[model samples]
Target: MSGTSDLEFFNTQLRSFVPPGGFDAHAHLYRREDAVDALPRHVEDESGQVGWTAYSRALERWMGDRRPIDGLFFTVPKPALDRPAANRFVAQEVRPLAGSRMLLMIHPDDDPADIEAAAMSSPCVGLKVYHVYASRADTFNAAPGEFLPEWAWELAHEHGWLIMLHLVRVRALADPVNHDYVREHCRRYPNARLLLAHAGRGFCGQHTVEGIEALRGLDNVYFDTAGICESEPLKAILRTFGTRRLLFGTDFSVSEERGRCVSVADGFLWLSEHNVDWELSEFGRPTLIGIESLLALKQACRSARLIDADVERIVCCNARQLLGLRQAATNQTQVTYRRAKRLIPGGTQLLSKRPEMYAPDRWPAYFAEAQGCEVIDLDGHRYCDMTTSGIGSCLLGYADPDVNAAVIRRVELGSMCTLNSPDEKELAEVLIELHPWAEQVRFCRTGGESMAVAVRIARAHTGRDRIAFCGYHGWSDWYLAANLSDS
Candidate 1:
């Protein structure tokens, strides 16, 4: 009854990609009485309620066989809605669904004690504060602190609960105010997990891309792929945060709706059946918003070079970890390797270090920290260096104390300047002293660039382009040309 015409679309486009036993990180649960205003037509159920059963049935219609194992449920945070009733409804509905969790819809004016009492009474895992709860009529432009009071942050920090924030402001994360708020608050409340809904409300895509840098090192922050119909923002998230930090969310009832939000100049516009004439389009027709979101996610994952395991993390494992639910143990090294293959050509910058060059999937392709001859991997396992020893570059061993001290001193004093550093001249003089036959010296950052320069100088001096070369000199075209018979 649900998927109907879209069943073909789902089967053809998403059936294989949509892994089973996944979790929905974001979804809504409530009844008619919870809202003072009428519910959206798509979510209006004949049973006078839209709980787990209704949600499952609706999901079955559209998703077919690829149903989520459980979901993080919340209620519509309309300005005039009865908040207590909504929370009660969600709590009652999800009590039987194992692994399903709910959040208490909180207003800025609500008492912290009541909020805490509600959380204690119910199985609510966190707080869901909305922009509509702000005191201003134009809540869209409301500052973060106006709707989400400091007490909520303090309470969440103390209890280690999550705060699902749907960011506002015309430019979303691109706005300096929004960026500062997220950075400062997240840093201040280290224990509270801040789940940014809709990928930082990245309807414009550019907003998320531009502002994602500000949130780079904030480990407590995370994002949800809920109702975003574009790939750019999702790609930006995956690239910046990697697979573990990005969670899959349907935005549920909104996902069931027929229109989507598209980026316009500087802002975004929601194109729904009510706003646009579908008959006038040259394209066939609009699919469900949820379907469009999945398509965008699929495209982003493909573009980001995510493997199946990476997809599983986004769709299922990440949420389980966030919710404290038990999940299958994953090898962090292998996971990082799979991600590397997708993001990096040959899974590494150096051909010698490629995972395929050694033990393949079993190789430790990355390290979290390195000291002397021992290296620590992402999973916290340590190893002794029996191989290249930092590809022979770190002959002094990784993080040698003398080298680190010099680098740190230079960095602290400002490593770069508009003018050349005197250290360059001193280093060149030292090199010249080492080789008495050479009076002048030039420097290049890498061996490849230096080899190219050397080739250019030799060719210029002798007026000859051809020369005999041997074994693994560099990546310069001059060195690579040996493979070509014509060359």
Candidate 2:
């Protein structure tokens, strides 16, 4: 099933990266008879069937020591395929495989009665809806509602079942219509767990990166690292949703294929031995798509600074929890820190406050409450004032009685309004009186903004564009310009 190069690549590049046992969140299992026509060239099984045995054998060939113990299995969703027979094949194949589950394939127009019967009779965990079932010829551009009808949502909601949606459109998740549909449907059917496959079909990483913001805070929503071969989309998903919501997957059959999807221009393109001349390439021959996907995931985990436990959750624990199976324990602080690295650049707003500046993984990266000189972390561990004290901003020792009373009084009187407060004039008078040489004062919100304003005033008054000063004044453009080579 795999050549010597595949074995070498697995040992050197993917062995340590992949954990002991994984759960493939996305995969297919069916026979040739299930399809209306010949199967795609990517299906490499000579026996004309790809059941649990075939899948296991394929993994053994390339995975070496690490392979998925279970998978979320489904059948090929061709428009003209025999739906009943295909589903029966899937049900039979996965029934005896403990911890493995199957999703019933359905079209928009399918009879709900029949679907209900199949669900009750078999161990079907959810539904697998595809675009090919749409009425239009160009199903790639079909909307989610076109193929996945409202009835499906109702059924899923009523049963609390999951829906593995492979979003398809020109821009995928980046499209506003897709965003609106996902947001509305998710809100409407709160009980139906929506698993966005392929990181919301993020073959083009930009689509996911640009559109992931809209789906944030939707607890029912989740993502699977399926056939995606790039780290950008995975990193974006990890940043938005922690490791618990990001399930590891191998889009098998396709994963067995030798190729990778690359982002090209506004869309994505697939490169395979059939489409390109591997012999003429400067690099070595292409490995399995599965291998490429694993490498990309490892890179994303490294970039996001995910711990071993975080990686374990993505590869094994998350899927188990989603499937109503037992899950491994995880630390909340580590989970939050991983998310912060993805959301906040350098993992913190100020470099001095970064966890790496303290103890990295061992450091408590967040706080639940603060009072006086003591702070309580998420796990309720208390620490007294010993270090920078909130980067010197908390010299008053956090939530001081006088400061708290003054803040409360100001807030009660309305801290902000359409009209300027008379307090500004009084503050200006006090500042000018403190420094007799100053005639007036300009107020700004932060140190960086104040620095920028000061630089502008100095340039305008002196009629000179350049000035020399040192020692990290602020993050203003003028101050940061010192970092440039020509400066």
Candidate 3:
């Protein structure tokens, strides 16, 4: 899928990174070098952490799915014109398109107009303030539990701004001591909605195990899935806060953290491999890669799914809605890579048949289910299906009937039991008879599994973990062993 078709596929269904239910309200990005440092007159550390152009250079190189970046939450640390500089950098240089990329935090200590200027400056959707670590300005302070007053909160709230506040360690959402301020602001200006940075780190931090009951009914409160919390902690926060109130964030410069590292392990490599494979297919070079990381990323998403599709949607949507950027771009070829990513490791799941190498438009042949294989592509062409189904195991068709029927029979017969199914014996006999070279036979499922099992048999027979093959083989020592235990 490419162009508007690709964008449509991504926005509607093809883009799988978005959480299925709500949205990831918070996502931060590092501005490696000021995008617009036209005048280096005022450059400093507290201004902003910088990294990668809009392409997600470092991020995609790590997470495997940099293509879905909709927004970046960041703050102009300190500088006379840092905000203006950064905005110009992003708007004119980094991502000059219909899509949006933004930074929402306010450096309250600076002139307050910069705060409103920040809002009106770019296409940002909200405002963020870490009054303690980032700001700590006395004026924005609200009260006991309140840092920013009701009137101040209302100032940003009236414009439909989603506020992000870092309430250092205040965990109990309802704890009067910590929450009296929030109550005051919510009552005085119920409209000033706030997303607690670390989900009241100290209050609920120790008792995350205490769960949903602690903050069951707070409608205006929100939390970002980041900081001392990640993975399971993130899911818990989502549950306690609900998908609507939970957003996705990596706490800026913290992408080096374990969670960030793990998130990109597969996705980053996928993009790396996809780019290389593409060049290889066109120019005959290759991205030497194994499936472990890709499989790991899949497993990560899979584990999250156990909670509910909504969790996934929230993570994805939060980024999109916050930035107002569509997932798939009208002119991007990358969506093709994202679409075929699920089933294949590095988009192939095969040792040789690298599908990622082809252009997005060229992927139809590899897929057996193109809407029209003959005379339907407008140019009146026919395609010969080329995807090797599980290393030559998919002869009947992709999701074929006869093959599925036989497997279904054995599966229902209890393939794993005290006694093997009669069908297994019959199939083994037929295979041995078919190939006189097969003096011994073993039962296994999946081409990868079968090939690995065959290698084990070969080792037993010839005392070797080595073998040579003629065609595309999966997980057959030369393939599966490539993943190794390290994977």
Best by TM-score: 1
The CA lDDT at 167 in model 3 is 54
Residue ranges of candidate 1 with Cα displaced over 4 Å:
35-39, 327-487
Residue runs of model 3 more than 4 Å from their true location after superposition? 1-55, 76-97, 107-114, 132-151, 169-176, 202-204, 207-215, 228-232, 257-308, 318-487
Q: What is the lDDT of candidate 2?
A: 0.84
TM-score of each: 0.72, 0.69, 0.43
Q: Please tell me which model should have the higher lDDT, number 1 or number 3.
A: 1
Clashing pairs in 2: none
TM-score of 2: 0.69
Residue pairs clashing in model 1 are 3-61
TM-score of candidate 1 to 2 decimals: 0.72
Per-residue lDDT for 305-344 in model 1, tens only? Answer: 6889889889988888887875545689899789888998
RMSD of 3: 21.3
- Write down the lDDT of every candidate, Cα atoms only: 0.86, 0.84, 0.45
lDDT, candidate 2, 381-442, per-residue tens: 55675888888998987766588678778987899999999999999999999999999999
Count of backbone collisions within predicted model 1: 1
- Give the distance in Å from residue 50's predicted Cα in candidate 2 to where it truly belongs: 0.7
